[model samples]
Structures are given as structure tokens and as C-alpha cells.
Target: MTAQAARHHAEGRLAEAVTAYTDALRLDRRNPALLSGFGLVLRDLGQIDGAATCFEAAFALDPGCVDAADSLGTLRAGQGRFAEAEACHRAALVHCADRAPFWNNLANALSRQGRAAAALAAWRRAVLLDPALPEALSNLGGGLCDAERLDEAERTHRRALRLMPDEPQANNNFGHALQARLRHAEAARWFRRALALDPGYAAALCNLGLAVQRLGDGTLAERLYGRALRATPDLPLARFNRGLLRLERGDLAEGWAGYGWRFASGQAGGTRPPRLPAWRGEDLAGKRLLVWGEQGVGDTILFSSLCGEAIARARSVVIETDRRLVPLFARSFPAALVRPHGPGAAAVPDCDLHTPIGSLARVFRRDLSAFPGPAGGWLVPDPARVALWRERVATLGPGLRVGIGWRSALVTESRRAAYSRLDQWGALFAVPGVVFVTLQHGACEAERVAAEDLFGVAIHRWDDLDLTDDFDGTAALMANLDLVIAPATAVGELAAALGVPVWRFGGRDWTQLGTAVRPWFPAQRLFQPQGGEDTPGVLRRMAGQLDSRLI
Candidate 1:
């Protein structure tokens, strides 16, 4: 090749190099060297089929042309023809048995085909052959990350970064490992650096958004998601996050449709069993609909109320719910069939239509004005369970049967927004003539310990309440309570559904559309932070409300 063609190829000016290589090949049509050079240039230009043709022509003339074989293999790998790529790589290995790049390319093909063990071994061989192969190191780290060996993945990422400190993939991989460790701030910093190194780094941008969202700065998170979408509109997770923000804002039209990407984008997994088809917009007239639970117990209870509404749109309704609440829901929605959720949970195939219990609101939800008021009393406390609870509460003395919950699930890392400190709960604890009963589980171990340590008064304990921490327990407890005070979770929803009086503490920026007074739950009262999430003020208000309600 001419010096000009070589310079163009070296500078990554693939189109110019392709033109020059084509000109040289046309003059020496039968020259295997010229044909091989032309193929490499075509491959660099992303003209993979053309590159394969040129590589075939070169290999036909010189059967042992390992470069031509390797190029063809790499092209086939990019096209997802893993078997063909493996054949070409093996052929190239016969001629050049120690080529690390060829081995790395073979590993890439193997990893794509779900042969991760073989991929790791091949990658180890490539790294052994060429210790400076940063690409091989990075790919190996990703494979380890997929296998959940996060410590090994972290070490491998650091190794790749040492070779190339600004490598976007290495930085992104390191961020992922940090995120798995719950080091959101550190993860966000790494992802930001990756984005700075490659401004169009879509994966880095998405990770940064997720990290910030975990940190409870939805404003910054939304901006990062927008930036990612600007860089790549088709990035599904970015679209999904944007949709979540919109949904949170109550912009249902665009939000619900964008929300559909979770299942379609391969994010929400366990791939909804194929035996049950998704409820596409089809005819539901006179058909039985089986609405089943898919997420947490609280989410199940909060959304299950919509099942009766869904039944209004179908011929018959059947519900599959968490086993803890199956008896309760069966008793409540007797018009519809109800079953406890379990392995091989039978779906009423007799139902022509089906939707997740959560999706009922998506299909039939109405405007705020139309949010059906508390319908059936699905959450009645079992007479037996309530009697046991009464006996338990009676032991604490009947100042007032005040149930308390101060923690949410561990689904997100934003703890400060979800739960005020134990001292915040002191507002009600100090209130005269009230017994503080613990209903929350998990994370509160510290709070519980501190409360007992700080104050000699041991608050009433019912840790064995068998309450599933879902709204059902809340429902049963609310029915027996003088008043309920809890964080913004499914319990709050349960209290609302039961039309039982509750004091709800919420984040500062909760949707203004749903004011502190919720119409859906007539007895529900919301208490938000006055200045900057004043937990004391929320408790003080709850104490005052309880004093007024009882006296």
C-alpha cells in the first residue's frame, strides 16, 4: 500500500483508507496482500459484509492468510454469527497459533453465545499471551461481574484502568461493582468520570442517573437521564427512568407507555411465564380476568384494590395474592375468585383476559376525581387475630392503642427520605396517655435499641406480629387501632383503604396534586416537613391529632 493509504488507516480515517485500498486493489486485482489490506479498511469502516467478501477473496488466493481469516472471524462475531466466527478463528489459529487478539476475539464470540466458562478460559489465555491487552482484561471483568463475583470484577477493572486510566468501559465496570456494594456516591463519581472521558457514554450516563436516584436527588437524576437520551434516544433504561419521573409527576399518558419498556427491554425479568400471555389491548367483553401479584406484599395490597375495578371491565375476576392475605382478600372480594400465591400458582386459564394485579390501575385507573373511594372492606382484621392483638395491647395499658411504623423496605438506599430518626418518633412517645407499639421490621433494629437505651421506658414490643410488613397487617392493625402513624409505604395505603385514621409522614416534595389530605382515604391525614424534613414537627402534629381525637 502507498504511504498515504497507510497514514489514513493509522489515523482511523477508515473511509479514506478504504478508497485508497480499493484503488490499489483495482490496479493489482489478483494481489492477496492488497486484497487483505482492503478488507481490513472495510472492516474499520463498518462495512462488515464487504470486508468479509474481500477477506474471502484474499484467503482464496493464499489459503494460509491468518490476517484475512482473523478479520473475517471478527466481522462474523460482530454480526452475531458466533459458530462461523469460531470456525474462522480456529482456522486462523492453525496458521498463527499464538495470536492473542484472535483468542480475545474468539472469547468475545463465546461469551455472546452463553459459554461464559469457555470465554473466561480463552480470555485468560489471551491475557497470558499478551499482558498488555487492556480490552481482554476489561471483557474478562464484565464476564466476572455477570457471574456475581464482584470482588474479582473490581480487581480486574482496576487492573484494566491501570493500563488505561481513562478507559470508559473500565470506569463503568468499576462503578457497577461499587453500586452493588451500596457505595452510591463513589459509584456516581466513577460514572461521571467515564462520561467526561467519552461525552456520549450512554451506559455511564445511565448508571450515574441510577446512582443519583438512589441518593434521593431525583432532580439531578432526571437531568442525567435527559442527557443520556440526548446522546442515545433509543437507550431503553433512560427512557424508562424518564417515564418513571413522569409517572411520579402523574403524567400518565407518556409515562405508562414508557413504563411498558421494563418487560419489553429485558430489565424486569423472570420473563413473565409464556404460558400466560400479556394483556394487550384486546377484547375483554364477558371474559374472566386473573389479576395476580408480582411485586412486594405492600405493592400487592395497595394495587389489589383495583382488582374489583378491573372486574368491572371484564366478565369475571380472579385474584392470586400473597398467601398471608389470601384469606383476607377471599373474604373481602367474595364476588371474585381469590387464591393464595405459591409455586405453580394456578391461573384461571378459564379467564380469557389476564393482567398482573399491579397493572389493573394501569388499564382502568381514572382521574383523581374518579379514584374510587374505599370500596369493599377487604382488610377486616380476623376476629381471632384482633383478639390476640387486643390481649397484647391490653398488657401495655389502654392509654390509647397507637400503632407505629417508622421504616420502609430496603428496595432503595435513600433512607433519610423514607424514615425520620428514632428521636423523631419521640414526639408521640412523649405524648401523655399514649402507648407506642412497634409495627415496623428491619432497619429499625438500631432505632429500637437506641430508644430503649436512651429511655428507660421500654415501648410495647410485638416483633412476632406475623404481620407480613405488607398492608394486610396494617389493615388488620388499623382496624383495631385508635390511630396509626407510619411512613409513606403500603401501610399508609392500607390505612387509607380501610378508612381508618392515620398520620402519614412524607418527603418534602411529594406530589402537590395529592395534598396532605387524601380523599381516597377519608380518615387519612398527611404531615409533611415544615422547613427541611422536620421529623419533630411531623411527630408533634401526630401527637396533637391523637390528643384531639381521643379527648
Candidate 2:
């Protein structure tokens, strides 16, 4: 209330203003104006505790003070005392129910309590009271995002930006909503705007990192994530993004350890639902470990290679794999127990160590040279299935039986995106004295029709020989083939595990193991893209390799 204190506060000299206000408050302890002025100066100076004390004293002197109550509630929210903040907001609302800022504060307090529906309703009321409440609209968008209503969330955020074009929080929130909708390009644009507004905005930087990662720029993503970490070290999203980048670059040892932070982050790319607890650097020696399968059946088949190595160290190993694979894997690993997949009467016993099938490779994996070629075939053919497959192969023809598969696995986004073009198989079928047999499963109707059109009688499509639908049947048929040529897939792995001669056709930038001949499977050879539109050329080369070796 003093002229000197007011002048200092107006000049943005908050520390000086606080000292002058404190002296004036000391002179007249009962003056509400002096106490409230001191509290505002203290709050600006970041002395939250002192500010709260001053606000409470001012409110005691004048019981109907709105600013004092609002400041006190904000301090409580900062301290993470949501219940106390809610009480303060509600009391302030009783005095001034129609105030837009008070309603926004109340909604924020409700949101902190995890009452998202009530928070949304309060935010709607706040916006109705003041249409220009950009912060309120942004908060509403956040609530909608929490509810997983991404489209509406995007619209709300855009509306906020339209009202306050340069609002930092609005830009950040809009970017986040766009990213949620998988609009990576647009999200990157909004995130850049947010960064331009405030260069050290940690959340915006982290979101930009994720968007760029989706755009397939891992190096830039890593740099952005690192910058976010420097700005806010405790941001779990940035930490998890850094971990994923490391994992993608094949730094599995540190990657798995950094990946443990996903549990702490409530991000979308965090760990999927697991049937068993994830292995957390727990000592597995002398402990019964249940390695439960997650994701698709082929992933289970690919990961099963690690079971033998893991079982060597553990007291006992119990594998809970896909039901279709039980007959095959059980025969291969007689030492370890096998349980069929899905719900059963069997109680999941409390095991000292449990790991998802995917994580096993990280712990007990070897380099390409050291890969222990699974003896014989882990996926054994059933007698009846073999009989059925033999009948189908005989019906196809008398030419050199060349098994051809083009599609990759179709479980996760990564797998679905890794398919080999069908034209890649055309040149191999065009080769002399070779018959193209369709070995792929989950081929689209369009792909199947196209295969028939391209290869004619040389291409055989048997509905009964689906690798995904019946693994045992496919294994039996693969066992009878002269040569198996396919994309770097689970079936390719399975064929090699069977010790059958296979030529793997790879994408231009495929797995490193697929680029070179795998020593683990001496029976296998790799034919990668020589560069551009040359899948046909890769296939022609593989046909030559097969003609020289097998013919």
C-alpha cells in the first residue's frame, strides 16, 4: 500500500518491493492492503511459503478477499495439496461463482483429483463465462486427451490457438493432440512453434522428439530428447524416448536398463500388457522362471530360440507359448515344461523370476557368429500334417519345388511396415526349371490374385498351407521343399532352424543379420536389394545361387 513499494512492484523490482512491503506490514499488522500487497510481491519472488502466510493473514483481516484466496489456492496446487486447493477454490467460488479465472482454477484442482468428467464440466462453465479463456480451452483439451478423445481434443486446442495465437501452452497442447492422432507432420510444426515461443520448453521439445522419431529421423529425435532432458531431467517421456532410440540402434544392454523407466512414464509407447511380471535384473539362478509369450505367434517362434540358453542358467524353465506351437516346442525342449496358451484351471505359480518371451534375447543373446543354430527343427511336423502337406505339394507339380514367400510378419506396426513387394518374387519364378510355391500367410486378397496373375501355374496357392494358421503343417511342407526363399520372416527363421536350404530376400535396409549369410544356419544364404527397384534383380541372383547349389 506504500508509494515506494508500489513503485518498485510496478517497475518489476519484486525483491526490493517485497522488502519494502514487509517493513510496511510490520508497522501496521492489521492492514489488509499492506498484507495482500506483500503476499503478491512474495509470490512473484518465488517465496511460496511466505506468500501463503501473508495471503492467509490478509484474508483473516478481510474475509471476502478474492485475490488472496486465489493466490493461496494456486500455492496449494503448486505444493501438490490438491484437496486443500479444491477447498480454497470452492470457498472462493462461494464468494464469486461467476468469475471465469476462479472457475478455471477450480477445474484445474478437480483435474488434479483425477475427476476428469467434473473437471471437464467445470472447464466448460469457465469457457461459457469467458469465451476468450485460451488457458481454459487448453486445459479442457488436456482433459479430453486424458479421456482418449483425440479428435475433440485437437479441435479444442486449435480453438485455443485461434483465440491466443502465440500462447505457448496452447501450441504445446495442440502439438500433443496432433501427435496422439498420429499426425506426426502437423504435430512437428506446432511443436516447432512452441519451441520458437520458449526455447527451453521441455514438454514441447520432448513431443517434437517423438514426432521426429515417427518421421524416421532417429538422430534428430535423439538430439531433441537430449535437449528436453537437459531442460527437465526428470521428464520420463524424454528418458523413455532416449531409451527407444538406443534400442533401435542395437545397444540392447543399456537399452533394456533405460527401458525400465517406461513403467514410470504414462506415455503411449510404454510397455504393453504383460501376463507375468517383467524381469527386472533379478537373479534367476536356482529359481523357477516362467517365460510367457507376448505378441503374435511368429514372435513367440522367433524368441523361442533363446529358451535353451535361458534354461541353462535357471533352476527350471516353464514356457507358456501359443497353443498351436505347444506340440512343436514341447518336442524340441523336453527338459523344460510347456503350458498351452490361454486361460486354464492351472494357477500361475509364484515364480522367483518371470520374463516376457521378447526380453529373453536381451539377457541371453549372442552375436550372429555365436547364434546357436537350434538343433534339427524346433517346430516339428506332425505325422497327419506332413501327410496333408505332401498331398498338396504333389498336386502343385513336377518342377523343382521352390517355396516362395513375400509378406513379412503382421503383428506390430514395425512388422506390418516391413513387407517385401510381390514383384520381388516375379523374377525368381521367371527362372528356368523352378516352380514358385506360395509359402506366405496373411496375404491380402489383392496380393494373392496378383501372385496368380504374375506367376500363372508356376505360382501355387494352397489355402491349406498357411504358415500363420497352422505352424506344424507349414513346417512339414517346408521340410519337403527343395529350396525355401522368403523375406526375413519367422518362417524364414523356422526353415533355417529346420536346416533346410533357404535363400532370404531382404529389403534395401534390412536387419544386419539378413544382410550377411547367417553362420548359425549354414544352410541359409542372403540375397539383399543391390539398390532401387531391384527386388527382381535380388530374386534373379538367389535363383542362380539355388540352381548352382541344389540343381
Candidate 3:
């Protein structure tokens, strides 16, 4: 009977194996080996609880049954009980320390518990025991990448590929390593290869879309995302990428729906634990609502525009925002309670409902026509700080007072191309009556020196102000400027929020939606490069516009 059951399992007839195993177990109920075999067949049939019982009985009957312990560990790991899984794996290893599969299973449990170092060690041991284990090699490569050891990760992934050339996951992971190094074209080829091996590979398809997007081919990227979605409709990555693409093309309805997938896709940063129910455009007439910030500082500023609408609907609103913006938000929305994110967040009064700041767009600005027009500015800078900067600007000899920020905090190749080089701003610097004030934050001393030498203009710098940490001070300085020219960084968003005249530069980013102007900021004008034109051409066009306005 056991031989027949084993033959059925080997032939992939799981139901027949389960039936045969049950008959054998009934005949010899005390046999630990029979119970362990039955447990494995039950597990394959997805009867987790039944399988667990059989494994437990087998272990109790004979504690030396390493297979039973290993099987139990795998079952517990699948159930998200990592501690129990670890104990089972440890017990199994005591009996068979050299078993590569047991070590790999232990590594999986450790990885799930966020013990990266321990997981990596176990994976190394497993690979050392069985050098031909492709899965262990692939996992080890991923762990190396997580630790930022890119060179080792690349080599390990290549080794895995050499062992199993058609392994979909190994190919996908190798592409990810290349993508991290910004080698998008090479990464795209690997992703294509993965798709060739497994046509319905959703993750590979989505990654291919991202690579194509970085290559400045949004159209192809959109099609690739579509293919991914067709393969796996519930894939969050494909949905999220498709959403951004649709929004960039001005398809608001579908775009906003896709945008809702951000939280599930792990793209949103600083997400708080879900304590209160999410508001789905429901009535908040008498409810205390919490609108917490998600994503970057720039997104917080841009989306804060919708607070007024929420304030009008809700009885009382509590806004949880970045600490730097707390004072600004408190003053801006006097009717609501503004609290800084982290530590003291729990001290705030409980709310009837909560919503993410970005989610407000889904409710209020679903259509382009639904967007609010210039309500002057929602954020108000300190009048005292404004006056201080106003007096300081008098030392610059009284020109047009144009503030310039030529870089974003993100220094990726695509972002750099969108922002342009400091030397490319020569045309704008040559404008007759313009004096450039440096609003750029971070390490820009070298860029500033190069720009001054290359463009023959003094780009003024203020060492006293910490632009990165002191956004309040930055806003005050921006309020006193005649105009600010920047990329789609937080600087542009901040200046526009303060009602400063901002000429913002960007490529085909979703935020602007390929429009001449964005509905979120009336004080800003969008400057896009002409067909096949580089940053120099865009700057020249901006210089012409500045010349017309100043003259």
C-alpha cells in the first residue's frame, strides 16, 4: 500500500496519493514514517491543519523523525509563524545538519523575520553544502544586493544564471541588480529574456516597463504595463505603473483608481499603521477626520491644497504632516489641529475616519474640471522672516532677483537629465537685468563655482540658511524673490505653494500631466523641452521668456 501511495505521489496524482496514504495510515496507524508521508501528501492537498496534526503525531511517536520536523517547519513558515518554524528547522538540523534543503528552509524563516544577516549566513551554508542549488544562490545574491554589496550580488546572480539559464526568478533578479546600477538597457534585455522563458511573468513585465520608462519611452512602458496587467490583473506593480502613465497622459478617472494601489504596492513611504477606517468619500459632516501625509515632503505640500475641502466637509480635521511643515500647516489651517508625524502621533485625539493626503485627490479632484483654481496661496510664510529676507536681498544690487535651483535631491540619470546641468543655465544668466540667488539645497558648492566660472555671473549663496531642514526659512526667502526657476523638486513645489512666481522644468512627469500649467499651482509656469531638444534648448526658451517678461 505504501509503495502504491509513493508511486501515485511520484506520478503527480495527489488525490490518489492522499487516498492511498490514508488507507496505509489506517492499516499501520502507529508507524511514524507512514504518518509523516501522509502528512506531506495532506500538505500537498492544502489541508494544512490535518497535515500539521499528522506531523505532530509522527514527531511525538518518534522525535528522531527529521522529515516530520522539516515538514512541520515548512508548514509553519507558510502560516507566518516564523518563531515556531525556526524551532522546527533547528530540531531537524540537529539530526541532519548537512541537509541543504533544511538549511534553505531555515533561511526562508529567518528572512521572513527580517533577520537579513542570519538569513544570508544560512543561505551561504546551504549553497556551500550543495553548490548546484540555484534557488539558494539566487537568494544569497538578493541578500547581498539588500546589503548594498552590488559587485558580489552581480557575480552571484550570474552564477545562478549559468546553472539554470531558463530560471525566471534568477533572470528577474539579475535584471533588478542591473536596474539598481542604472544600467537600464542591459536590465531590459534580461527582463525580456525572463519573459521569453515564462511569457506570463508579471514581475518581469512590470520591471521591463520601468526600464523602458527610464529610457524615455513612456509609450512602450505603458504597453508593457498593459501586458503585465493582462497576465495578472491584481498585480499591484503593473497597476501602479499603469496609473502613473495614465495620469501623465491626462486620463484622470483610470489614473486615480490606479493610484489607489500605491499603499499596497509599497511605493508610499512613512505609512502609519491602519488604526481607523479609510474614508471613501463618505459623509464626514460630524466626524473627526485624520488626514495624514504620505510620500515625500513635496507631495505633502502639493496635496495640502485639498485640506480646505476636507475642512469644509468634516466637523473637525487633524492633520499629521512632516515635522518641518507642522508650523506652516497649523498656521495655514487654523480651523484644524496640525501634528507632526512620529512619536507624538499616538497622543492625538482619536478620529472617526482617516485618509491619506494623496487620497484626497481621488475624492475631490477626480476630474480636471473639479480642480480648484488659484485661491491665492494656502500656506502663509512668517511675515517677520519675509521681511528679514527682503532686507538681505537689497545687497544684491537690485536686479530681477531670480532664484535658481538646478538639481533635485534624487541624482538618478533620468532625474539629472530632467533638471539639466548648471552650465546649461548660461542663457538665462545672460538675461540683462537678472541676478541669480541660489535656492539649491545639498552639496552644490562645486556646481555653483562651475556655474559662476562658466556663465560669468555671480550665483549668490547664503551660508546661514539650512535649506534642507529649514523649510520655513526657505519659504520666507522665496516670498521675497521676484521669480524662482527650478525643476520638479520640492523647491519648485514650496515656492509655488508660497505664491512665488515659479518657472518649473520637467520631462514627461505625471505631476504636470504634459500640460502647460498645473491646476494645483496657478503661480507656476511649466517649461518643457521642444522636440528632441536637450536642457540647453529648454533653458534658452526660458531665457527668451525671461527677457520678454523683464524688458
Compare the candidates by lDDT and give the number of the best one. 3
Best by TM-score: 3
TM-score of each: 0.66, 0.61, 0.83
Name the runs in model 3 displaced over 4 angstroms: 1-7, 20-40, 48-132, 139-155, 176-189, 209-227, 343-349, 413-416, 421-432, 449-457
Give per-residue CA lDDT, model 2, range 1-551, as digits (tens): 48899889989998789789878878888887778778888888888888899888877778688778877998899887988888888877888889999889989999877688999999989999998899999998988887777778878888899998887778999988877777889999999999999999999999999899888898899899989999999888788777767766655565555554554565322123334565654677888888777655655676787788778888898887777777777877777888775556125664656776767755764334455554554455667767877887787767788777777645332343345677556555666777666777764557767767877744666665565767777778887788887776777877776666777776533124332544445556767666454666666787677667546
**lDDT of candidate model 1 versus the reference:** 0.72
lDDT of each: 0.72, 0.74, 0.88
Give the TM-score comparing model 2 with the true structure, all chains together.
0.61
Off by over 4 Å in 1: 1-160, 172-192, 207-227, 230-234, 263-271, 281-283, 346-348, 373-378, 387-396, 409-412, 420-424, 442-453, 462-464, 469-474, 508-523, 534-551
Q: Clash pairs of candidate 3?
A: none
Give the per-residue lDDT of model 1 (tens digit) for 1-551.
Answer: 65677789989988788788878877889887778888888777778788899898888888788889888888888776998898888788888879898889888888866688998988888889998899988887877776666788788878988998988878887888778767899999899889889989987898899899878887898899889888988788888776666666666656666566665444553324425666854667887777777656666766666676666667887777767677778767777888875556663356665676655555665345556564434455566766766666677776777777776755343344567667666656766777776666565667777886775546666555544544355455567777777887666666655656677787633232234454345456678776664677777787777777667
Q: For candidate 3, what is the TM-score?
A: 0.83
State the displacement of the C-alpha of residue 237, model 3, in Å, after optimal TM-score superposition: 0.9
Provide the lDDT at 489 for model 2. 76
